[model samples]
Target: MTAWGVVRTAFGDHDVPSTLMGVTVLGYDGQLVEIEATAAVLDS
Candidate 1:
């Protein structure tokens, strides 16, 4: 969780999955886990 703390998109920058740390993700490709905030993105 670096690079200015989670704020990258537009097909660039994003890594942390590390084999899906915790659980309850619903959808995810790869490299971007770092748990704590599931519940559908903290209730949106």
Candidate 2:
């Protein structure tokens, strides 16, 4: 998933969250893909 990779990379740079820490819930809204990162995004 290139899109997911990009998001992961960007988040990694911003210290937001990576796949290791966050749970990505991908949802389809019509023709667009919506990504929702939960609380796991925050390293605790």
Candidate 3:
């Protein structure tokens, strides 16, 4: 799944991109894992 959001901070609100994924054999134990990742873009 994919999503979009925003982050609130003292500087300002920033755009955040996120994603949810399922993975197989992600670790040495070979277990099923669900991962969520998010990143914010800050103004320079």
Clashes (N, CA, C under 3 Å) per candidate: 6, 0, 0
Per residue, candidate 2 scores C-alpha lDDT tens digits across 1-44 of 77678777766756553554443653554455457856634466
Q: Over 4 Å off in model 2, which ranges?
A: 13-44
Q: Which candidate ranks first by lDDT, i.e. highest?
A: 2
Per-prediction TM-score, please? 0.15, 0.26, 0.26
Q: All candidates' lDDT scores? A: 0.45, 0.59, 0.46
Which of the predicted structures, 1 or 2, would earn the higher TM-score when compared with the native?
2
- How much does each candidate deviate from the true structure in C-alpha RMSD? 12.4, 8.5, 7.4
Off by over 4 Å in 3: 1-31
Residues 1-44, candidate 1: write the lDDT tens digits. 75434444422553434333446664757746444554223353
Query: Residue-wise lDDT of candidate 3 within 1-44, one digit each (tens)?
Result: 22222223432553334344555445667566555666566698
lDDT of 2 at 23: 38
Decoy 2 TM-score against native = 0.26
Q: Distance from true position, residue 30, model 3, in Å?
A: 6.6
Worst 10 residues of 2 by lDDT: 17-26
